[model samples]
Target: MKKNILLIGGSYGIGLELVKQLSEDYSVYVASRTSEGLEGTSATHITFDANTDSLDITALPNEIHGFAYCPGSINLKPFKMMSLDTFESDMQLNFFNMVKIVKDTLPLMTAGGAIVLFSTVAVGSGMPYHTSVAAAKGAVEGFAKALAAEYAPNIRVNVIAPSLVNTPLAKRLLSNDKKIEMMSQRHPLKRIGEVEDIANTAAFLLCEKSSWITGQVIGVDGGMSTLNLS
Candidate 1:
């Protein structure tokens, strides 16, 4: 039997791309509210909503080799216009729920298992209209590092902090050619991140190739975090 990998959200975007890449080599299990875009993958789909429902652990394999949480939000609003509740909501979706899932399912992982989480480039680089999400994702980055230290040599934990990508989650930002061009120019790469860019790195982290890596936040940004070419 192949190794099992559980993903919290794999219906679309980077998660779906990772599912497509990993299912070929591992037994992929995806837990999401809808099986939309997963119609033909070899993955086992479980209906789950992180906002309200716990993972249907009964549907998972006895042992899980990897896990990734892919659900995220891109709330770009002025700080003052946004209330405290806005920040809390981002925390609930991005940090608290992930913590609950990992804690609940970690028992299924023994040694050499990898856990992947998502953050944002804004977490490290201060961007206007990103205060709420940046705070939330900052918590995620901090949590991943601590978790990795605690579980070192047993389970590997890492984070992927990405810049804007051309995913459904960012459709509004890159809706048109002019907007796409503007966003692209902000990065040294001069192009927005593709789902594959993030997913490929994610797949590597989950596999034995990255066996020695953990307790780190890998930037998958398009050189936006560290680049100054004027």
Candidate 2:
């Protein structure tokens, strides 16, 4: 039987790649604000907006084998210039919304199910101008660990923290050749990440290969978080 999975924010970026990979074997349902009609032949696309509302999981399959929350922001600003609202907005989008979605869908994800959430390398190794995003993603990291422990022997929850990736959201950061070169050099691997890099890790976490792993914040970055040579 094909496993049923729900992918929130799956229109583009890492989420879209996930839909593509997972759809090869498992049945995938994509929900996103901008996703109109289904783009690929494998997955089913549905209209959804995480910032304003929650998904209607009641209409979904009872056996939800996998779930992933992929909506996030790169709101990097100086601490002196940041406002309380900015922090709140990031928290709402990155952390709180995911909690709501997971809470709503937990019933369907019985034992053996897996939930994958996105984080950033900034959460583990802090960088300048990352206070807001790091705080938000830090909460997600902490939540994943706690939830994994609480739901032990049943559902599995894990996180993937990636470094700079070539995505529409990251276009501004890597708009020019100079910026791309500089960013690539910062990582130990000497190359910035591609969407498929993170997508493949997500596929592993959702598959039976990683069945024993939970509450892990796997770094998909190009050795940015761990290794450094200067």
Candidate 3:
């Protein structure tokens, strides 16, 4: 039998790439706000807004082998300019909703299953202007580790912390050639990340090959989280 995987916010970016790859072998259920780019795929799409709506658990399969939460925010601002509401909103989207989804889906996951969540390089490596997002993703890192320990020997939970991926979510930061070059050069790999770069790693963690791995924060950030090439 094919494994059942649930992907939250799988309509675009890295999530979309995951849907394309995983659907070939596994049954995928995509939950996102729109299905614009998911046409011509066998994956099932469910309308969901992590910011407002709760997931309809009845729509998911009884036995889920993989779960990936792909919704996140990139709010870059100085600490002084960032407000309490900004922090709250980021936490809601990046951390709270993720926790809720896992809680709701935990019962559905089969033994040896895996859960993948997204984080950012900023959470580990300090970067200016990443106050809001880093703070939120920081919680995600902690949550992933704790949940992994809590569900050990059964479900594996891991987080991918990426740096400046060239997705719609980071379009603003990479809009101009100068901005792209600048961001690209900031990393030791001399290029920003692609959606597939992160998606592939996420897929691995969800697969049986990585069954031994859990409670780890894997960095998919073009060598940004480590190395001092400068």
User: lDDT tens digits, residues 22-76, model 3?
Assistant: 9889999999999988999899999999888889999988899999999999888
Badly placed stretches (over 4 Å) of model 1 are none
Residue 28 CA error for candidate 1 (Å)? 0.4
Q: Distance from true position, residue 55, model 3, in Å?
A: 1.1
TM-score, candidate 2, is 0.97
Off by over 4 Å in 2: 36-38
lDDT of 1 by residue, 136-216 (tens): 999999999999999987999999999999999999999999999999999999999999999999999999999999998
Task: State which candidate, 2 or 3, has the greater TM-score.
Answer: 3
Question: Least accurate stretch of 10 residues (summed lDDT) in model 1?
Answer: 53-62
Q: What is candidate 3's TM-score against the reference?
A: 0.98
What TM-score fits each model?
0.99, 0.97, 0.98
Model 2 lDDT, full chain set = 0.90
Writing each residue's lDDT as its tens digit, candidate 2 over 172-196 gives 9999999999999999999999999
Pick by TM-score: 1 or 2, better one: 1
| Candidate 2 collision pairs | none
User: After superposition, which runs of candidate 3 have C-alpha atoms over 4 Å from their true positions?
Assistant: none
